[model samples]
Target chain A: MSLRLVRIDDRLIHGQVVAGWLRALGARRIVIVDDATARDEFLRDVLTLAAPSDVPVEVLNIADGAIRCIELAASPEPVFVLARSPRTVLGLRQAGVPIEVVDLGGMGSGPGRKRLHKTISISPDELAELRELERLGTRVEIQIVADDRPIPFRSLDSTH
Target chain B: MGFGQAALIALGYYLANSPWLFGLAYYTLFRPLVAGLLVGLILGHPAEGTLIGAAINVPYLGFISAGGSYPSDVAFAGWVGTTIALAGGLNPAAAIAVAIPLGLLGTLVFYGRMSVSAVFAHWADDRAEKADINGVAFMNVVPGQILLFVISFVPVFLLALNGPGFVKDAIDRLPLWFSDGLVIAGGILPAIGIALTMRFIFRGSAIPYFFIGFILFTFSGGSMSLVVIAAIGVALAYLHLTFTGGLAPKSTEAAAEIATAPVLMTSDETAPAGRHLTRGDVLRSWITWSFFSHANYNYERLQGTGFAHAMTPIIRKLYTTPDEIRAALKRHLVFFNTEPNFGNVIHGAVIALEEQRANGAPIDDDAINSVKSGLMGPISGIGDTLSQSTIAPILLALGIGIAGGTATGSSIPNFAPGSTGNVLGPIIYVALVSVIIVGIGYVAWMQGYLRGRAFVTDLLRSGTIDRVLTGAGVLGNLVLGALAAKVVTLYLAPTVSIYGAQLNIQASVLDPIFPGVLALGLVLITFWLLRRVSPLWILAGMLTFSIIAAFPFFGPGPQNPNDYSYQACTSSLLHKYAPCGVPPAPSAAPQASPSPAASTAP
Candidate 1:
């Protein structure tokens, strides 16, 4: 219950999440679960700096993130989780993290990525991973901000 | 209403959206408060225009349009909605009711413009392929601006020319209950804006500052102006920073780590002395970026075309062969977007990398592109929070406070007709915003060039940005609290039948406890609801609640029944429903008045 929000946004620890979501959800901690970011020392420093100094930030690989998230879920302090892609979330879920809802906040358009919703573009591999996440009994919704309506991932036409 | 006036207003709209003003117009003229003044001046009612614009701007106080997605198009609302209001002779509150819907419709126009501008990005891509630098620049500014002019001007011109007549006719025919509902909606709508701002700045530890501001304003019995409150806020912010040790440097370890990090160079790569770029070339590049970063903003590539256009001076200076020029242009022309002011650091670093590459360094396209894509997100995160969330909102709240006569030393008065409190509000806002934006943009740009790729790391680790953000958060919360007290108008209309005596909740109970407890409560409730409900729904709910509550013995009477401007507004629009010309009897209940429309209906 302490895991307040699990979001997939490529631009992790950015303005929308910090200024908009963190306060909205009253989450005190941010857990960035991305292998690439966890491996890169400079990116870790940059992301740590990007967040407010009061809130603690943890940049962990998938395996470590899953363990940390489980511990956080059992704790009283609220935690906000952010990942770069669906694959990361899928990794966490397979690692036995009880995730009930997955919010697709932002995934920028790039090479080989197809538009799925407003400002959210994902590759075929990502789309499949999201479908897998849904099949694993997690609700996937696309919501950019707290004020926006959450659109279910299943409702969007995935043909393109 | 004249063709000439309408055309002038439309041209102003075009210029606001266009890239010709070095991005100053977007921050100034595009705001409804300023746009209203401009439109009113065109139509010979500058004071009324400023008031209406300020009213329309109330609900957009926390507005933030990040990454090409706008919640509402206030610019469109400013120009078209103000024109319609002025032409129709609607009061400030009613004008807000009309302006809110117009702002929603403007999002469609924004998306349309963004979608179509993608074609121009493709055109620029072709020009880059052929190494046609002029073609690339032309595509960035010319076609995109033309499309903007057409989209922004044509609709505004037509709307301005004909909308007032239609609105006047429609108002003349509107039913009494609906017109009453519009006024009530206007009074209630400002909460949404305040709540939206609270979503961002109202966080842990900063929460107390909000209450401090609210208590100061509410308990001061209307004696303290927003300026006084803001002064107190600044002092408190400084004290808070001092006690929290936020001003102390805590990132020396990170800075040292970055300082000593080894540069990754291939073992076989030779270090060649590259042709050094003059500071003037970098300055020119930065100037182009500051002015035209979003000149050809499109959905496909976002700021990609604008990026290539900015790099033209850099490319022209660094490359000689056609292939080299083509490669440089094509690389910069990929998808890019960030907050234009603080995001300049990325551009500066890219320029340094380009210079190094042209000098035969081992860097390739992937290295430069990775740097851009990687830093853009984090930089934009900090940049947007600082500029959009903190700086813009605080300044805007100050401007709004001054314009609405709540921040000045004078007593807060109802917005009387043709009474512009201070003309200096908008001017001060524009001047301050321009200086900050241009100053920060230039400094960040130059620092990026001078410091190269390590600049962002250094800037973050120095703890200066954190201190600024922390201070801004404190100031922002305090000001927003004061602003909510000043702007959000909510009165509990229903009186409780206590011991067979009428007890007005707002006057008898609430005011004794806290002067604006109702308004503060409404803002907090709306802020809480924003987490679970969409803003559009909250807007609809408020509109519905206002209408139903305005019924007899239900909601409070007209917001400012005794105010002269409210009389002027009601008399002009609701003359057929009730006698607005004659003042209401002081002892009689507002609902006790006989309605001419009700009598004639049967």
Candidate 2:
């Protein structure tokens, strides 16, 4: 039950997953790491309802999610980890979970963010944390859906 | 027929390019129904134009152009389809049959343009790396327009000038069985669209909502307006959200509480925040991006070059050093795509972040890119569903129904084909859609800037979007149900005589239970088949079935214009309650001959 893929998508469980990503990843379990979604029963119900019936979905806060990810590291079953922000993925990685790759799926345009890609908008703080994660040997890639080729994380050649 | 009409057709094609240049929605300008009305007005036959447009548009109701993939060119179909239909003096149904083949051929132009656009994107990339902002903007706009003009103007000018005679000749030569197959095929094509929509909206819990819409419209005798259905749907969705406690703890309170919430494993780094961008700067970027996001769309980066082009104004404002500007430009020049209207908020937020980075925040390329990558998928998923799938369909159906009017009589004045009210249908649709898109886009962009990162988080937590989606789902399902009942035309022609009593299968069996039961069943079956079989296969099957069935009373040719109505047995095969092969005389109705004399002998 090792973490198969860690994805960052603010909308959480929606069509890109149920229709596009699930088939692409062929994963049977989804663990959503978000404090707000985990505590809110209504959100949890909605998320579960939104996902396909066959994919067992569980929503947990960062702490429990990290523990779950660590526990699943030993199992043969592949587990998909999802969170709303890069911070959560960083949190899971810092918690000693061996996440090999982090996939950034969606982040909406908001104030104080820049458009890096069509579906992604990020704040400076979020960007810093992602760079730190990349430096820590966790490869970060941005892909819109399952079918798309993942673009490797690239940074400005600051030496110039 | 004349230079002016040809010019108008060419103009419609040119306007279709506005999605890239003027930032006007692609849906508004190119949709066959809407384009038809515009073309009709130019030709001094708005009513005829609309009738033709509506007929041509029906087959493409479920059309989607996600990620710049043009499966069939609706714009080409609408402009050329209406032109050919009107010029050839063909009935709208027959015109639809004519237009489909043309639309498929238009895909060649689409791919040609897409392939050409990539060269420009590469040129823009070279300019961007050199920090030539003006050059990048020029590449985004100029070459694309030149290419657009050549593709749209040449074909339409020639087609409108010389092709009408050819169209008439071709249509005349087509066998009745084949022509009839086209009409039947057109009537049943909406099922494919409805099924595709069902695939998008279907979830286990949401299934019941679909039925509610279906049952309500079925029981209403097909008289209920979509507006009223939408209003009721909104209320039901609200209740569902509130009763389920989906919107709880209030988003503001949640945002405030969650700020202090503990992360068990992650280290927290507190970066000092400072104001950098003015509202004017952010708005400037939005305007630049909205109009030119896909101006230089290419196979290599999609919207990547446009992304860099949009950030030019902000990049200039913040970074004075050439290296800084170069870094900023390179950062944004990456692959990106999303539902443009609802997804612009991400742009707004990123502008704010860039401002902070200029003011000494530790933001680098990866952070900005990472955020964009994360949001693109989910926002696009939601945005595509909201804008393209749900809202557009509802608005179009309303417009089509209004323009079409009631089956038995004309409630609105006949401006041309049916009534002056038909014009109002498209008018109301364009206005309503324009207002909602602009209003929502402005709000999302501003909110992203004002609230910063917390804005999106708050939006999801507020449950407004979820509630709105649920409501829209309810409304969409009901409207589709109503549309299926009223628009999709499929019926049984067989009659059963038991105990000396003649009972019509459609009238006595299906009509009493619900209007359009056969149409609805066909739609559902198509939906099921869509899951298992490819769309191409289903389309082929529908064409085959329609043609084969033409051997009976339902033989392919022009169906009575009146036959496209919701009344089960009146218009189609049962010409006047007696099925087509059966003479009005009950004595002759018992004959074994199923073929109507009008059917072309196979």
Candidate 3:
């Protein structure tokens, strides 16, 4: 089974993903599970390029994502999973998927926001949602690029 | 409503109800580069996708998305940067350099609650389990990106990559007038996105200022620059906020007045519409002392940092429901360009929609965020295309040309943003951006109200785009008429002798039509004449005019204004070499050993 980091970062395949996560874990592939990115021939090519040449990229939105997931899990390839937002992460958690930790890397703040860090922001609901995730014991930590120690999302309010 | 819908509902339930996969999608799928490339491939050219990916990757190159409130336009930069770079033979470095401001234009596409994207993801997951093939495909496929990264990229990319030579050749061959018209047309086309955004954002108080700006500028004959006018706009916006707008009667502050709202007396709480806002409430929303910072204004679409601006007020309202609050928050969190008050109307409409939903109206966030997503992609495309790439460069080009003594320069060459009629270009640019921003605001706000939360989502759907395009086409045609009549300038004749029985046969044949009018007519006639001409005509018209008139008239011969006569500018350098004997010869200091005077004297 691959040691895959399925993460929700909304700014998908960014420097944090490629330079931060993939470089650290020695991940060899990135499998994207989002219908829009998968079936989109344009997005497929984009994700393929985003994956390091040494590693491979497989983009399959949910339905088709299953096949790749099943395949990668059977294979020994290391992988990273990515999406562009938090709810994508939430969706996976609800599927009862076995994941050891949830890494909150980066999602740039915009309108109606409260800054969580230099790179993260949350509406009150987002704060509450992460709090709920912590209750579920999902380790939610915010990091931009990997080197810096992650800030736990559980303590986001005061911590930020 | 068979398997697809059922599966979608299941996935929506599971994912909305789930957490892990939501994490998966956020991190993996919506990557800027991945999304860019995917968009390119879907559009048909992976290379174009990569190119766009790289362009978007440039400005945000050193960026770190620390807080969730990133006000950069990396995605949009990639999308429109790729669109422009791929559309023509623009230098990649130049394209990247130019795309920075354009990237910034995307800052307005706020996601009040990015989590809303996750809701749709869950919706998809549920439908997937139900074996709703079409639903799975659609929910998975559309993020308002079906057309951009999906269809257009490939064709444009192929054209850009392996085909500039063909395009160059095609331009070389197109009819002269037709090409100029497209150039003229292109110059004005970007205004649409601004127009729509602005319509929503411009409050009644802001209207007189728009006219003030217009008259002050036009009366200045396009001298009041955009920066100056924008300063005026900003000052006016602030002044209105401070003086006339502040200190409205706080009727709602009284508990009794608020209690008058038909409160849902049931177990928990939910307020009805008519009962929600009292006259005081109506007056209160518009009242504010500060212009931008205090949260009255949205900071607009291309500004990229107003989520906080809009959110502060709503969060403070406190009486708004969590769902309503969440929806309100989510509405502002959409990926949008920050063009300021003009773009804020989208914020207002979205908030209104959420308010409706909270009032037990039919709208919900899932549908709303989809609209936000849909707008982010295209508005980014249009915004960058208009506000940044097209507007900025075209203004710069026009300014430089106007400054460099060539009002005859094509509208498509360059761009910039500013405020002043001293250089009419920048003021025009600001006006155009202002107009577009307001127009977009109106579109977003009204659409939100009319279509409900599902507006963005419906936009993400495959077929609804025709409705938008049809509307744009109609508007585009109207704009074309405007361009033909007003924007395109046409006048540059080489010579006009007293009798005007010109030695130049071409001049004699064209005695009735002056150079300017001829160019303008040609522009109108070309667009009118050629069934559907594209952008190449710009090159052709420039080439023809540059050779036959501009070069022959202005280049070798000295160009002077009508009432002015030419005088040879004395050459400071040539004085040393001034032929044999000229009177005021050498300087008192020291002559170059043998000056023309000394040599002639000796």
Candidate maximizing TM-score: 1
Name the regions of candidate 3 deviating beyond 4 angstroms: A1-8, A11-82, A85-105, A108-117, A121-160, B1-273, B276-349, B357-386, B404-422, B457-602
Interface root-mean-square deviation, each candidate: 2.3, 8.2, 18.3
Residue lDDT tens for model 2, A101-152: 8888777554476656545667888888888888888888888666456777
User: In order, what is each prediction's RMSD in angstroms?
Assistant: 5.4, 9.5, 23.9
The DockQ-based CAPRI class assigned to model 3 is: incorrect
TM-score of chain B of each: 0.89, 0.84, 0.31
lDDT of 1 by residue, B1-602 (tens): 68999999999988877788897776888788788778878988776677677777878877887766688998888888888877876656667788888999888878888888988987888898899998999999899888888888888899999988787677667654555566566667888988888876787668899888877776776456777778888898898889998755546335677766644321234434456678899988988987888889876677888899999999999898999999999999987888888989889888878877887877899889877876777888888887777787787777776666432111222232323445555666777778988888898888887776577777777789878877877888898887777766665534557899766666578767887787789999999898878788898898878766555442223343223223221322211121234454332222211111111120
Q: For each candidate, what TM-score against the reference?
A: 0.88, 0.74, 0.31
Top candidate (DockQ): 1
Per-model DockQ: 0.47, 0.11, 0.02
Residue A77 deviation, candidate 3, in Å?
Answer: 18
Expressed as tens digits, the lDDT of each residue in B443-526 for candidate 3 is 654454444433433332222222232223222222222222222233322333447442332234442333223433454354
Candidate numbers, best TM-score first, in rank order: 1, 2, 3
Worst lDDT window (10 residues) for model 3 chain B? B593-602
Best first by DockQ, ranked:
1, 2, 3
